[model samples]
Target chain A: MTYERPPTPGYDLGMSSSPIRKEVDGALLAFVARQRPNLLAISDELAPLMAALDALLAEGKRLRPAFCYWGWRAAGAVEEDLDGPPGERLHEGIVNAAASLELLQASALIHDDVMDSSDTRRGQPSMHRRFEALHRAQGWPGPARAFGEGTAILLGDLCLAWSGEMFETCGLDEERRRRGRAVYDLMRTEVMCGQYLDMLEGTRGEAAVDTALRVVEFKSAKYTIERPLHLGAALAGGAPEVSAALTGYGVPLGIAFQLRDDVLGVFGDPAETGKPAGDDLREGKRTVLVALTLERATPAQAAALQRRLGDPGLDRPGVDELRQIITDTGGLAACEAMIARYTGDAERVLAAAPVPEEARAALNALAVAATARRT
Target chain B: MTYERPPTPGYDLGMSSSPIRKEVDGALLAFVARQRPNLLAISDELAPLMAALDALLAEGKRLRPAFCYWGWRAAGAVEEDLDGPPGERLHEGIVNAAASLELLQASALIHDDVMDSSDTRRGQPSMHRRFEALHRAQGWPGPARAFGEGTAILLGDLCLAWSGEMFETCGLDEERRRRGRAVYDLMRTEVMCGQYLDMLEGTRGEAAVDTALRVVEFKSAKYTIERPLHLGAALAGGAPEVSAALTGYGVPLGIAFQLRDDVLGVFGDPAETGKPAGDDLREGKRTVLVALTLERATPAQAAALQRRLGDPGLDRPGVDELRQIITDTGGLAACEAMIARYTGDAERVLAAAPVPEEARAALNALAVAATARRT
Candidate 1:
């Protein structure tokens, strides 16, 4: 039974509640609601964890799930011999798989927030921050830091454990299940390795930029976009050639996504992004953009940049000065150009991929939309 | 085809390095060694994590794996029908499943140590403790605590992800594989839920002794014994009746095992247990023994005990006093009696189980040894 992406509804991006979008949303919502009872079953003893999961699940735009459905639909359309009702089972599997991705993402974000000491996420207090506030309100002894961190760590572990349960109950075929497991495993490993590289680079200083970027590619790009998309395509019975083509498209798009994210880290609005402006600066994140800036800057500029980077107490003026320095050193333009180059590469790959022309066009549009997302 | 445990060669428990035990050790060591090259294939970015995992895996006793193998053998002995060469395949599955259990335990411990602020485990520094020390040595800020918690969280996630991968690759029947997956899911959920209960009880500080005992049963017994044994038996095609029988035998044994652990926490020799003497006293862990003491103490003694509970800087004299009070109040004897009662109950359950006589006897002996071991 083949599937194809339903035709794009004639609507602008400003219309957040498009029917086509809602169709996918409705599917995911139905899946989540049905699974809600199961989640609640597990939630009985893990009420705080359940609340944290609810918050994390609420944050995503469901883009990965959408990609998975689209991939399945595109594959289904190519199977000429199958003429039957719309493949609801396939759609359900894709939705469940996609939801698992979101859960996995939540697990990572919870831990990442704790690791970065991030106070807010998706416009609300981060899990650790909320926990810290509770600790203070209860007047716990010693320090709020330990209690906050301990709760967040448990919450993250809870999410990881629940994600595994979700995957186990996904109800896919044996072969597909194994394939999905492999994809999920690789995704997890990449994110963790990427996180490790991110920490190591910050501690080891300027000597590790190249190593850090490679980590970014595997950790951020491969996990976030490349593998997930490939997993979807692979589940749709895409052959080796099709998977290779998707990888070609996915890698550059993934890189472009992270590159844009880096740009936002330095310059995005805090209100929209939901993180403090220059929060990355405060955390001293050693992104490729930052690495490039350091490499290209004059000694004085580099020293000035270094002074402001990772200073958690840095005020508005410090952030402004650092932003100005990055721009003056050509880091902003260089990053933007890199983003454009990668996006173009992704577009080129998509155009050359041997899928249906309509599917290719839809994927190209998704790549553009993803890379250009404002926040 | 039936499987049975190899006859126990009368080897000294303390110092004997018998060939049979060595063979089991060799199997595990060789499997891990062969996988070392594949471990290298894990990205260079995760080198430190891989190193940590290598060290952690080396420290485990392979106890669960041994039980799994025995469970398989015990079940095989009664099997009247077979589909394949049951010996090698069943043994391999048991070993892999067993290894996966150890990995899961390792993952849980890494996170648990961080949550409990525990500094030592298995005679060595906890993973988080090591990371925290590193953070401090590098002159990181006052809150090196987050780094420690974050690293441990990631390490646990990595272990869980890898454990799933290992299980997925285990060559087994599809139905049996699904059953195994279900067992794993339940085990993870139970542990997390149990952990939440533990934290909640500690925070509330009003948990009844019964409530504390329930937490121990769910958190330790169900997870450590019942589930692991049942998983192995199910993998070997043991009927539902067999699983029920195993659970009946496992539950009380597991509780007895934990009671012994609680006793060791307060009075174990520091050198043998690889922890400071009275470490649990310092941490104010509200074990069943402590609960018993609180119930039986005089009003003045109870007040004094409550004041010292959870005191981070609890002194040696305080530890000594609490120990004396428990003994003076007869709580120590009561606790010991409870342990003995559970051990006796475990023996009754084993006697009533429907397994082969010899296999049942062997399991009973192991249970007694496990719960009664002094360190």
Candidate 2:
């Protein structure tokens, strides 16, 4: 398996992330190292999975944790105001708490790639593909594909378990953890349900715009943003109102962020996106953009779009035709307009939010970087 | 799509199970039903997954929880002595905590089936096959196998999550849940790492007895028996010595239990075993039995054994031949001897255990049931 990969995402975020990155990476690295001996103590044969996880962790966007951290600040936590060892402990604790999300994200990405049958992730061979290659190279008995997928599934399960373990043991107080765990539980269930529904949507070529939008809502809006924000607020011992306000801002911004990703999946440069152009179209994902295009296309155009959308063998010409059809049908315009609208909705929520002044500014900047990221 | 299944596998416990089964099943059903509306709220497309999970839960042996419950009792919990409301709460809470193991077991079984590429489970289509059939029935647009595996992965993930969730929310006090969580987390990592190592064993036709036994120690001995017992002890606020004592009893009993399963996999009646006869041979599991057989076999017999071990097309004659060779080379006898030795070791531990009188009786019966079961 080639270990080569593009620069990890988040370097391009329009923020000074060097310190935050170090702390998050430290927490992630430490927690992962702690779990390693448990697996390796059983057999050194399990080392490959640890390596794969480390690589995936390195490439994570760290966006959810970023939102979670700012949500902590939004709940009236000014890091500079609290000075002492306990305060430092709180800082380290929250960083570790936020870092748990990265572990969860890595888990989702591994399993999601298998579900999508995508061979690569973030410019590297995907987790299952890596296992598949290892199996073939080792001349292992049985079907290499099954071995690959099976190991990937197991590794993903480990990450998911680790995510929760890290969150619970992040040195947070009992009360804070109790509150945060509710949000954590809800977030996990939402993603599981959303992913299953979204997979179903891929099979339904004629799925409606509402259906596609709901998948985005469950998979992206809540999972990517709302729940993370709520977790941070809860961990900070914020009252119900703080969680409610954050949700208002997080949901729409998350929708816009996902829309941006959908756009990049179709149109962005491979270097910028770390995925090949039109990857979503190849996966036959019934995104809101595709639903809009199907709604507006002529009968013949719609039929052609459906035929080519999920064809794994679709060539450059087919992608170009689909892109052109999507543009001519005004689906691209509608999607862009919706992103603008959702971003505006999020901005309105931020304007009236009870966030502390510095946190308000940080959240505003994050919304921009989130919805407008090129990668 | 077909929901017919074998009678759930706990009826022949060689003890009265009527009341215990009701409480455990009630806890499991309630917890699962509680989580269902959240998924259905996203879309009813998730209902099939729910149904699949329900069917799986129905068929689980519930043996882990039984071990755990007695572990609690072994630590001085007496149901009859606690007669008040608080006592009732403790009873219900422990039951719920015990029930969580079934969910975790369900998760492992689903993914294990996918990994093993097994078709039927408990006289019905395996979880992945159920989804594959659903895809074919619905004429879904993708590889049915991929879709099936993907959905099963997600559903299994849900069960894993729910298992932890149930444990945390089992209405036990903070001290109990906190201690229990550590065991739960360790149990998860052990099974994951162990399962991966065991899967690798399937590929290595020449894996030795020590290697195979190590897999059993991690995958079965610890995961199936020791950890669950530890979780119960910890939750009961047992002291360190109590935990250590239980471990002495648990580990060897668990090894014997797994060896029994290995024997049944090769020799038991399909109806009683809930698996096809000689199934382990077809799967090419490098069990201690196989390893021991190789250790004793002549060069020609070993080569013949390797050639036919993992061929999926092995018919009755091929299975019979392999069985004959295993017996000739003393593999089966060696395995039986090992099982008897482990069981004896466990019985000695129990005899010296500081268990309550009634719990001592129950624990002995469970050990017998576990290692001597036909199914």
Number of the predicted model whose TM-score against the real structure is largest = 2
TM-score per model over all chains: 0.88, 0.94
lDDT of 1 by residue, A1-375 (tens): 112222331112212432335544454455446545654564464555566656666666556655654565455434332232453355455656666766677778878888888888888898888777876887755356666766777677766766666666665566776776767776777777667666656665542456656767877778877787777776667777777877788888888888878878889888667788988888888888888788789999999988878898988899899898889999888888888998899888878877877567667667766677666
Please provide, for model 2 over A1-375, each residue's C-alpha lDDT reduced to its tens digit, 9 standing for 90 to 100.
111121333343434643565678889999999988987887788889889888888876678887888788888766863342563367777888999999888889988998888988988899989999999999966678878888899998999889989988887777788898898998999998998888877764555888888888989999998888889888888878878889899999989988888888787778867787788888887888888888899999999998888888877788889999989999999999999999999989998998887767777777777877778
Worst 10 residues of 1 chain A by lDDT: A6-15
The reply for model 1, stretches above 4 Å from the true place, is A1-45, A69-88, A135-144, A207-209, B1-45, B66-88, B133-146, B315-318
Docking class of predicted structure 2: medium
Instruction: Report chain B TM per candidate.
Output: 0.87, 0.94
Q: Each predicted complex: what DockQ?
A: 0.41, 0.63
Candidate 1 per-residue lDDT, tens place, B98-199, comes to 677777788888988887888898788899887777778878543566666677888888877766766666666667778777777777767767776676
lDDT of 1 at B154: 81
lDDT of 2 by residue, B1-375 (tens): 111121333344433543666688999999988888987887887888888888878875678887788788788777863442463467788889999999899889888988888887877899999999999999966678877888888988888888888888887777788899999999999999999888887765556988888899999999998998898888888878878888999999989998888888888788976778899888888888888889999998899899998789989999999999989999899999999999999999998988887777777777777877778
